[model samples]
Target: MFYGDKLTELRELNGLSRKDLADKLSVSEQAVWQYESDKVTPRIDVLNALRDLMEVDTSFLFEPNMVTRGVASEGHIAYRADDRKSRKKTRTELTYLRYVEAFVDYFEGFLTQEERSIDSLRSMTKQQADKIQYAGSQREQNLEIENLAEVSRNYLGIQSNRDLMYKIENSGVCVVERNLGQEIDAYSTISKSGRSYIVLGTHKKSAVCRNFDIAHELGHLLMHQHQNIELLTNEEYKEIELQANRFAGAFLLPGAEFACGFATLARKSNPDYYVDLKSQYLVSIAAMGHRAYDLGLLDYQEYRYFSGRMNTLHYRKLEPLDDKIVPIRPGKLRALMEFVLKSRLTSVDHIRSLFHVRPQFLINLFGIDQHFFDQFEHEKHSYYGGAKVIRMPGA
Candidate 1:
């Protein structure tokens, strides 16, 4: 039977409407609606057109379970979109995430069966907040954030900024970097199967900024998982963002250690004085300055002076050593692909066939270049009798 839900999902994934698909198919809008409503099955020509347009095999239309393998309710996504443009972007991102969840589900079948564990800070934060008779005070919230940061660090076994990204991946969070356009910075979402995803923008020039973006998304994953972010008012959204910022700050630069290090600085307001700390902590100059202010190491006047000086130097837009410091890239997905290829478990073409997408789609989705897939394509071979063999010359 034709799967109407799959057709609807693919159309929406591609950001198309009934009219749009109908126009593309040279049919009436009602015909497209009928196809999606399961009132009528599309003709073979239309089915082939859909297969080409959606980048899926024609047989996928008949497979009712293909798209629904890992699909949960759309309500599971907790995205940050404050404007119309951002809402549109969020829809596109959510669509991509559905595909990613499916991919992960398909890939997991090839791996060893190990129990995946995820720590939810939301429940912990709530329990602590209840124990403290929590009023919605900023100071109390900050204290809780600081405590959670410490707990997260300890739980993940992260010793320093160097191990932070690795710990996140090891904890089973999928991190991806892509060009999300200029409208948004980054976003995170959780799947019904407890899979966490953080998508970062690739356009961030500074490694410090990229790190901050990742940490911010991590904050959302840990603190606000399963929350309906779309219903938040602007003020409420701002508060959530502020909490995530504080989480990132505390996570990157812990309280006592960072304070001890900052106390050693010769001049508190000098941007150059923070260069070594920036190199060590992988935090932006602005963030370090704010940390100094927040910790009372720099008084209002000193912080204002430093802020003015940084503005005068125009370091906010592009900081020093940005080009030299390499930004962190995601490795979990790449490592999985490498393991599969190196182990001879599968080829790139086979993976593409499983996903029912083109090679370019995988390249864009996985944040990899063409050469990465091209190498596998060059080595692709057919299997016969459960083994790939080369015919030998007759002796």
Candidate 2:
């Protein structure tokens, strides 16, 4: 009974193009229009494709003003936000102050807009102070940050390590370091469906640094998401950096428990004590030192001493600890790729271009070897053309 024009509207609303709709239908663009214009009634099978692809109730198509309700995920949650400060601000600790100042301004706009919109729609609230969510939807992705602040008891030699890093081994974020001239080694994007946050980091960073950077960005998401004002801005360099530091530390060492752990370790080791702690925590020596300082296990003098020694050891700077090619576990990134490929959301080339990384970067990530590209025609039957592998142009 419904016309194809109605189908077109739904498709557009759900962010689908005619070509995309056609691919899903296994038909031509013109045929799709015929059904919409009521020129011809599609068979039940084509009708089913319309229902599934558009995510609209086909039965409700003839109804008036029927908007497909996006099943409400948890509402947008933002942190005490601040704006980005001046880009010109030098990399000084105090510069972060300006960033926080501007952040206060930008954050308020988003919050006000959120309030007005949510009030118009049927909304529900979840009891959590802060959460990680996709940038587009601002919906919570990780629930652990809700208690990151209050969980630490700061008891004897113990800090409550709140906020969980759900070790999503099957999927993870990666930064794209290209063979090009200059580019930041990392990037972040919210999903179109508001389902997940995608972080692309170059492979140069070690797993620990990559882990910390991702957590740091997650901290920004949780802390500055819904603030009524701008957050640590360009001027508020120190505050922004401090927020990052606290977030990184909070996620990694945990406040109370890490402190207690440090105290217990420090008392036993004394001078060279952090060596034992470093090995135990599986964190960098610098991280160990900073965690000790945060837990009050080391006085300012002790902290200065340990920090200086670690720096001299070149642990955080130009030098690194023993390098071991730890086997890569398919993490959140890989999982997301699989979902995209299976769902036909976008092609593999589209994803690579969206992230602007080396094509080989993603393909090689989940045990997808690159050597097969040498002979696609002759090796069509080989793993290169296997169902498990999806080829994009750049890749």
Worst 10 residues of 1 by lDDT: 378-387
Candidate 1 yields a Cα-based lDDT of 0.72
**Root-mean-square deviation (CA) per prediction:** 6.6, 16.9
With a 3 Å backbone cut-off (N, CA, C), the pairs that clash in candidate 1 are: none
Worst 10 residues of 2 by lDDT: 88-97
lDDT of 1 by residue, 190-305 (tens): 77777778877776557888788778887777777645766767776777777778888988999999999998899999887898999899999999999888878899999999
For model 1 the TM-score comes to: 0.79
Reference-based lDDT, residue 145, model 2 = 43
lDDT of candidate model 2 versus the reference: 0.41
Superposed by TM-score, candidate 1 places the C-alpha of residue 362 at a distance from the truth, in angstroms, of 1.8
- Candidates' lDDT values, in order? 0.72, 0.41
Question: In angstroms, how far off is 186's CA in candidate 2?
Answer: 3.9
* Residue 243 miss distance in model 1 (angstroms): 0.5
Measured against the true structure, the TM-scores of the candidates, in listed sequence, are: 0.79, 0.44
Q: Against the true structure, whose TM-score is highest? A: 1
